[model samples]
Target: MRKQQRIKKNEDFQQVFKHGTSFANRQFVVYIYPKKNQTELRLGLSVSKKLGNAVKRNEIKRYVRQAIFELQSELKANVDYVIIARAGATDLNFHETKKSLQHILRIAKCLPKVRNEVK
Candidate 1:
């Protein structure tokens, strides 16, 4: 995801959480909000302190980032997505994380509609 497309302000997270819809899988709790910019999608990742130590938190965030990066193009445009990491994420292997991410995306209709879009 591009730097410009990352949701940085705490207010943005608050707004998204208050107004957007949410979907969850074993690893991630995804909140998505529609926006005016049809060509941009903002992403916010939250790995709570309760989940683990700093190393574990960062590691889980890295895994989530990798999953989102791979599906950047397929992700719907003009949406603000906040991904909250669950405790389950810390123990998941790469393939398991990938599958969990995909599962939530599919449920949320956030995955690209075309098969080829999900790379």
Candidate 2:
């Protein structure tokens, strides 16, 4: 994602957390907010050190990115997606984590019903 399009500003995160619509499931919390451009969807991943060491944190971030990539088509355009990983994420296996991600995405109504499971 381009830097300009990405939600890199701290204020943006705060706005999303404070006023934007949110949804949470087992794996991750999805925060969706409309943005200046509706032509693209940008993603943000938040994984804390409390979950584990740097390696584990990076692993979870990677999984989050992969899951989002797999569901790119299902994501609504012109929105910003902030995915916050909870402590439970570090312990879940890959497949289970994917399910958790899909759950939140569906809850956020970001996933298209026509699309099947993302492998």
Candidate 3:
């Protein structure tokens, strides 16, 4: 993700936290706040220090960033998404991290629903 596509300011984070609707699964909590007339979506990630040391935390953030990059096309524009990592997230590998993020985004209605069709 580019720097412009990230939610970097403390005020922006607080605004989203205060006004956004939240959804969660076992691994992540996602907060969504819609912005009018905006064409891009911004992402913010939070992994607590309690989860591990700096290396572990940075690894988790990397996984989350990569997952979001892959899933960007499926996500809604005109919104800010704040994702909080749960303790369970520390044990996941990259693929598992992507899956967990997908799950939470689906719950938050950020991703379009997939239809099951037998060909």
Highest TM-score: which candidate? 3
Residue-level lDDT tens digits of model 3 in 1-119? 99999998999999999999999888899999999988999999999999999999999999999999999998888999999999999999999999998888887888877789999
lDDT of each: 0.86, 0.79, 0.93
lDDT of 1: 0.86
Residues 1-119, model 2: lDDT tens digits: 44554677888788888877989876678899887756888777788878889999999987877777777777787888888888779888677787888877777778855457688
1 or 3: which has the higher lDDT? 3
lDDT tens string, model 1, 1-119?
57887889999999999999999877789999998855778889999999989998888877877888888888887899999988889899767787798889889988744466556
* Candidate 2 Cα deviation (angstroms), residue 54: 0.5
Minimal lDDT window, size 10, model 1: 110-119
Alpha-carbon RMSD to native, per candidate: 3.5, 3.4, 1.0
Candidate 1 stretches with Cα past 4 Å from truth are: 112-119
Which parts of model 2 have CA positions greater than 4 angstroms off?
1-5, 114-119
Model 3 off-target regions past 4 Å?
none
TM agreement with the true structure for every prediction: 0.88, 0.83, 0.95
Ranking by TM-score: 3, 1, 2
Query: Candidate 2 versus the native: TM-score?
Result: 0.83
Q: Report model 3's TM-score to 2 decimal places.
A: 0.95
